[model samples]
Target chain A: MSLVEALRVSVTALATHKLRSLLTVLGIVIGISSVVSLMSIGQGSQERVLSRITAMGTNLLYVRPGASSEGRVRGAQGGAASLTLEDATALADPVNVPSVAAVAPQVQTFAQVVAAGQNVNTQIIGVTPDYQYVRNSPVADGDFISDRDVEARSMVVVLGATVADNLFQGGSPLGESVKINNRQFRVVGVLKRMGGTGFGLQDDVVLAPITTVQSRIMAQRTAQGGRTVSSINVQLAKGAKTEQATGEIAAILRQRHRLTGSDDFTITSQEETIAAQKEVTGTFTTFLGIIAGISLLVAGIGIMNIMLVSVAERTREIGIRKAVGAKRRDILMQFLMEATVLSLFGGGVGLLGGWGVSRFISGRTFSGQVLYTVVPPHILILAVAVAVATGLFFGIYPAARAARLNPIAALRYE
Target chain B: MITFSNVVKVYKMGSIEVPVLRGVSCTISKGEMVAIMGPSGSGKSTLMNIMGCLDQPTSGTYQLEGQEITRLKDDDLAGIRNKKIGFVFQTFNLLPWASALGNVELPLIYGGGVQRRRRALEALERVGVAHRARHRPSEISGGEQQRVAIARALVNNPSLILADEPTGNLDSRSSEEIVAIFRGLNREEGITIVLVTHERSIAENARRILHFRDGLFEGEEVMA
Candidate 1:
């Protein structure tokens, strides 16, 4: 018999048991939707992180306290005050490290700022004047902290977009005074609105003079009399190799610190940070795919189970067809094609549903910027291929059993 | 013409070898209407199965219209059944999901043709069930279902028609109606018909009859 004829017969057979066929298809629907939704969300977050990393100026390295432990444990840095102001000064010496073009040391602590009876708990960043150039972000309003403000220890602050929005209620706060933890500070500037990254929400911080933050709002207090900075932003000179400077900075810091078994700090550039984040997101995406794949397997099992039952129930019908000149392949094709159609239909619906759901949720961000969950064409193809392959893999044994049925015995089956 | 020499069918039921048709032989010429009769488990159904190409005989030579069919491959036997033989079961055996026209189109589909609807409708008309061609088997009467089954059987224009207790599932009135149709098909169309039944009244409708007991054919009688 022709394949077209077999497909028609299978469609008719499935139509007769419409509810059963739909129920069988539901398992695959749930499985494929999970895979599609998870993959798109993972891709969306990856793209967001990538853009944020690029937004932070290229060829800039961050020298933060605490070293990463090798092997099993993945630990977060910036836990220790091992980064001292002298280390930043030593790295800024052009005679010792000629590859360095600029350096911006920062100290940050969460502080409650009250302005015009409105209050907000936000990060207060203490940075040098070069932070505007190194971080590639300029103040949107008024003047930024200058060398005079740092030397004078003036209690002046530049608010992030969110902090300013919360404190000023949309009114101009350029010349306003806001209290930082019961201490008065004048608002000198407001940063432009940059979108939030998954980590280190740069648009939500309040910047102040470093000397002011060091003496005032410290999240961590030190017992030693020496001053400690949180981290230093080091920029490479134009056309200089980052790898060579990284080695030079490591050596300089090691010799300055006097003695070290493992270096007490970690230095990372934009590329290294992006690669690590990509690795983490890659592992997360793989984990999501595996979990979703298990459901597809379970759906396949459901298909096989239903197919076997169908074969058993249609024993007499198969026998009748065989007696009417249907070959083993005809019977086999009828059942196998039925399975393929079912799963493909389910997978198609699942793809659309997953896309709709992801798009719907992505629109709900507080920042109001649209984050699209990217569904690649290859993933669409892979989903369809997997559904078709699942049908073929699970449909074979039941179809073969139907094909091998003895016509005489099958006709006799009630 | 149909021919079989020393055809035997032995079935192994678990450890015991239960012999069904032991060295039986017979022949029925073309355009003849014949009936096979025996008690239950006497191998009448087994003989009919072999004649219909649904089962292979253990050791025998059976020829259908001068072609050797006894040892042919399973698929080849199916092809023979598609083009050369028509089969009717006692239960009618119509696919429940299909209409009468769809059921009648099965053999013609296997026989390879795109002119399905016209041919299927013509077959249904020939069996006097054309008016109900769109009805499912359960939606029709028992006699009408039997007629549809007959149409499905003859749709491919087979050289031989094998009916295994075709009227066994019907009431007396339906049984008589089905037998009359078979008799007319044989007399008017010159189609060869073979029937297996235990009922004496059903056997008497054929032109010739073969009596058997315990897998052995005793004798044959010509109906007047």
Candidate 2:
């Protein structure tokens, strides 16, 4: 029979049993929906991570003290006090590294910040004026810590947005005195509400001058009788060659630390770390997409089962058709058409369902916002291809059965 | 033309073999209207099945239109059946769900992209059931359903028509009407017809009669 005739017959057969056909195709629908939705979500998360990393300044780099190989400080037994405030000052000197924009030494300590009996455990960050530009910290309410604040060792701190909210109950925290480890420090400014970072919430801490933090709070001591800084935040000049800047910065750090082959400080660029994070996220999404594809296999099995049953049920009809002059290929094509139609219908419904689910989820949560942004078109096409392939693969057995039917016996069959 | 040479059909019940057609041999020429008459269990239906290519002889040479069809593959035999033969069953084996027009169109559909509706309507018109084409098999009388089946058989315009117990379930009036239609088709179109029946009156309408006693043709008589 011609393909048009075969399609007509198969469609008529399916229309005759609409409920059964619909129920059978539902399996494929669920399978395709799960695959498309999961892939969209994975793609969305990948984009989210990439965008978040890019948002933390393009030319920013970090220098931390001591090689903690295997989580053990290389030099000191307990904790390595390798980086010092003098090393940061040496790197900041334009004569040594003119490509450097700003270099800020930081010392972090956990302390209970108290204001009007409300106490919250928050990180106390010691930074200079340059820290704001390096970290992309925006002030939402009051001014950021200035150069004067760092020079005079001002007994003042800037509250991160969340810390301001927690300590003063949403009131203005600037000019209010908040005790850090029982030492009263007047609030100099309130920082903006920076969203979450890879490490934690960006707005969940208080900022202070590096001099005040080292001399008054924490009071951490090193055996060398030198003030210690945990890490140095470095910002490179716009359009400066990264390789040249790294080389110059390394020379300055080497001279300041008086080190040779084995350096105590680790200098890493934000770009390199972000690239690594993107690679990991990309791999994770691909793995998730593969796992979701398995459900499509199960759906294909369901289609195969239904097609086999349809062949069996329509044996007499097949016989009559063959007896009346239907070629074997005709019968085969008829069954194959029916199976393909079922799968295509299922795929269409699945696409709609997947899109609906993705849209709904994206409207509800923060992660969903990222998901909505990264809709993968290839995944949709793959889903449809899987559905069509399922039809072809599963339709074979039933089509063979129909094709191999003996015309005479089928006619003789009661 | 149909020819059977020492045809053998055996049935196995456990290990014992019961032969249905034991080396039966027969021949019928083109354009001949013949009926095979016998008592029940006389192997007449077995002969009809072999002649219709519904069953191959276990060990024998059968030829249709001078072609040795005995050793032909199932698909090759199906091709011959489709191109040359039409069948009308005793139960009127019309697809119950299809309308009279749909049942008649089935053969044309299987014939691969002919003017299905026109051929179907013409077949129904020939069977004198054109007005009842929209009625399903169950909605029509038994005689009407038989006419629909005959329309289905004739729609493909096969050269040979096989009718097995065509009037076995019909009343006398309906039986006469069906026999008249068969006689007219055979005489007017010169199409060869093979019928299987035990009724003497039905056997009398054929041009020749072959009688089966045990598992072979025992006697023959010229009827017209």
Candidate 3:
């Protein structure tokens, strides 16, 4: 028989038992829809993370103290107070690090702040004026900390968007005095909300001048009487290679720290951080894909089960066809086509359903964040292909059994 | 034309051989209406199955239209069945899900033809069931269902039509009508017809009747 005729026969057979066919197809539909939606969610989250990282500026690098690992044991990241303000000064000079554009040294400590009766514990970061451009943070209102603020050790502060909202309740806190660690500081600026990143929400910090934070809020001094800073954010010059710049910065820090065997600091570029984050999200996507694959597998077994039952139930019909001169291949193709048609129909419906689900739930706020789902065309194609393959793989045994049936015995079957 | 020599069908039920057709030899020429009459356990059904190519004989030299059929492959036998033999069952084995015309088209489907619908309608017309062509077997009467089965058997224009108790499930009126259709087909189209029935009246309608007893042919009679 021709393929078209075979397909028609299968469709007719399935149509006769609509409920049975639908139930069988339901398993495949659920399996395929879940796979598509879950994969899209995974891809969407990964894209979101990568885009956020790229938005932070690709030419940026972070220089922080302490190696991730010590000689025999692992140490907390950025725990050692090895980076100092002098290191930032050395990096800013073109003579010490040629690819370096500007350096913003920061010292961070958590402190309780009070403003008019509202009290909130928030991260206090002491940063130089170059931090606004280096970290891609710009004040949304009022003026940012000026260079004179750092030189005079002025007790002026800038609040992040979240901090400002919580402390002043949507009211402008500009020129208002807030106490940080019981030290009075004037709120000079409010930073724009930059959303969340791998480091948590950027809109929940407090910024002040580096000198003021070192002397008044928290003090950590090295043996040489130099002020210690937590990390140094370095912006590389445009057109400078990130790999070469990272090597240059690591070499400079090693020379300044005077360690021969290994540097007591870590230099991380934006590309490396993005790659590491990608690995994490990639693993999460793969894990979800595996779970989806298991459902598809179960659906495939359901297909096999239904096909076997169909073959057995139609033994007499098979006998009639065989008696009318159907070849074994004809019988096999007819039954196999039935299974494939079921899954193909289910896959088509499931693709649409999954797309609908993705659209419906996409941009839905969960815990104050909008979740996204992205379904690529290749994933759709792969999903349909997998559905068809599942049908074929599971249909073979039942079709073979039907094809091998003895005509006389099948005719005599009740 | 059909020929069988020393045809023996031994069905082994797990190491115990139950012989059905033992050393039975027969010849059926072109354009003959023959009946094989036997009671239950007399192996008439088994003989019909072998002649229909639905089962192979244990030891035999069977020839159909001068081709060596006993040694032919399963697929080759199926090809022969498609092109040269048609079967009508006792229960009027029309697909309940299919319309009368669709049932008639089944044989031509396996026979590979582009004019399936036209030929199937023609076959249904020949059996006087063309008006019921669109009706499923379940929606039609027993006589009409049997006629549809006959149309299915005749659609491929086979050299032989083998009927196993074709009217066993029909009333006397329907049985007579089915037998008359067979008679008309044999006389008008000169097609070979072989039927298995235990009813003497049905057997007598054929031009010749072969009596089977205990897996062997006992006697034969030619009618006027």
Candidate 4:
């Protein structure tokens, strides 16, 4: 028989028992819809994480102290205090690092602060004035520290938004003296609020001039009259490739550190961080997809069960068709067609259902970022392909059973 | 034309073998209307099944239009049945879910005919059930259902028709009408026909009647 006629016959047979057919299709619909929505949600979360990482700055690279290893026992990252303020100065020079735009060196420690009976222990960051622009933070009220403040070792300080709120309780703290480590320093400015999770703690810091922080707060210095810093934040020039700049910075650090087999610092670019996050979310998406695939397998078994029942219930009809000269191939095609139609129809509806579900879940705010589900074209194609394949895979046995029946015996079936 | 030469059919039930057709031989020419009459368990149905190519004989040869059918494969037999034979059952055997027109179109669908609806409608017209074509078997009377079955049988325009107890469930009036239609197909269309029935009055409608007893042909009577 022609395929079109066989399909018509299958459709008519299914139409005879409408409720039964729909119940059979429901399993597949649920399976495919879950797969689509879960995968899209997973992709959405991955996008959210990558966007958060890039929000800090794409062209900026962070240089931190590398792990210090002593005869196979390795200390944690940032344990080695090998980086110094002179290295930050060298990175800021355009002739030494051509792709360098600006550099800010930081020396940070947790310290207790007191102001008018209010005392809070918080992070104290020592940075050059260029930090205001390099870290993309600007003062909301009062002026930031001047470049001359670092040279003069001035005791001027800037409060983060959270510190300003805690110390003054919504009152202006500019020109007010706050004591850190039993030494008085006047607050000159308050940093703007940087709202986000994971990095939102940036709003709870106190900033001071690097020279003043080294001389008064922590009185620590490297041998040979050099000054130590915790980390250096380097901003790359526009149109500069991160890999090239990273290589150039590594070469300069290796030369300055002198006789180094390995560099004592680590350079991390924004793309690398995003790539690491994508790997995590990709595995999560695959895991969710595998879980959803189990339901599709169950749905396939359901199709097989329904197809078998249909073949048994229509044995007499099969006998009639066989008696009228239907070959085994014709009989097989008819039953197989019925199963494929059921699954494909279910898949089409399920795609729409899943899309609706994802859209409903989209635009929800989580941790200060808008979450959105992404349904790529390949996902839709893969879903439908799997549905059709499930039908065919589970359909073969029942269709073969129907096709192999003896016409006389089937005619005699009650 | 049809011919059978000492054909034997033995059915195996588990470990035991029971012979249903024991060396039966018969021949019916084109345009002849024949009937095989026997009581239950007398092998008349078995003989009809072999004649319809629904079962193969254990031994001996049967020829339809000079082709050796006993050795043909299942698919080849299906092809022969599709192109050269039709069947009518006593229960009407109409697909209960389909309209009379759809039932008539079934054989043409299997035969891969393109002009199926037109041919099915024509077949329904030939059986005088054209007005009832839109009704399903459940909606139609027993006589109309049987007519629809006959229309399905005639839709393929096979050279031979096989009827198995074609009127066993019908009233006398419907049975007579069915027999009249078979007689008309034989005389007017020159199509060969073979029917299985136990009623002597039903057997009398055929041009010849073959009596079956205990898996063998007992005798034959020619009608005037």
lDDT of 3 at B57: 92
Best candidate (score: TM-score): 3
Q: lDDT per residue, candidate 1, A30-135, as tens digits?
A: 8788888878877877777777777766689999888444565646777666777678888989888889998989998887889998998888889889888888
**Candidate 1 segments whose C-alpha is farther than 4 A from its true place:** A48-52, A65-102, A146-155, A181-184, A195-198, A211-228, A235-241, A251-265, A363-376, B171-177
By lDDT, rank the candidates, best first.
Answer: 3, 4, 1, 2
Instruction: Kindly list the per-residue Cα lDDT of model 4 for residues B109-223, writing each as its tens digit.
Output: 8787888889999999999999998999999899889899988888888999999999999999989999999999999999999999978999999989999999999999999
DockQ of prediction 4: 0.75
Fnat, model 4, is 0.77
Model 2 stretches astray by more than 4 angstroms: A67-79, A89-105, A155-158, A167-177, A182-201, A221-226, A234-255, A267-294, A363-375, A412-414, B5-25, B39-43, B54-61, B66-72, B213-215
Winning candidate number (lDDT)? 3
Each prediction's DockQ against the real complex: 0.74, 0.49, 0.82, 0.75
Worst 10 residues of 2 chain A by lDDT: A69-78
- Report how far off residue A175 is in candidate 4 (Å): 11
Candidate 4 lDDT tens digits, A222-306: 5445777888988899999899999999989989888358778899886787788999999999998999899999999999999
Q: Is candidate 2 or 3 superior in TM-score? A: 3
**Sliding window of 10 residues with minimal summed lDDT for model 3 chain A:** A195-204
* Candidate 4 Cα errors over 4 Å, as ranges: A68-74, A99-102, A107-196, A199-227, A235-244, A258-262, A363-372
What's candidate 3's i-RMS value? 0.7
lDDT string for model 1 (B1-224, tens) is 88988998889989999999899888889999999988898988888888888989998888889888887998998888888889988888999889999999998767787799999999999989999999999899999999999999889888889999998999999999899989998999889999998799999999899998899899999999
Each candidate's interface RMSD: 0.9, 2.2, 0.7, 0.8
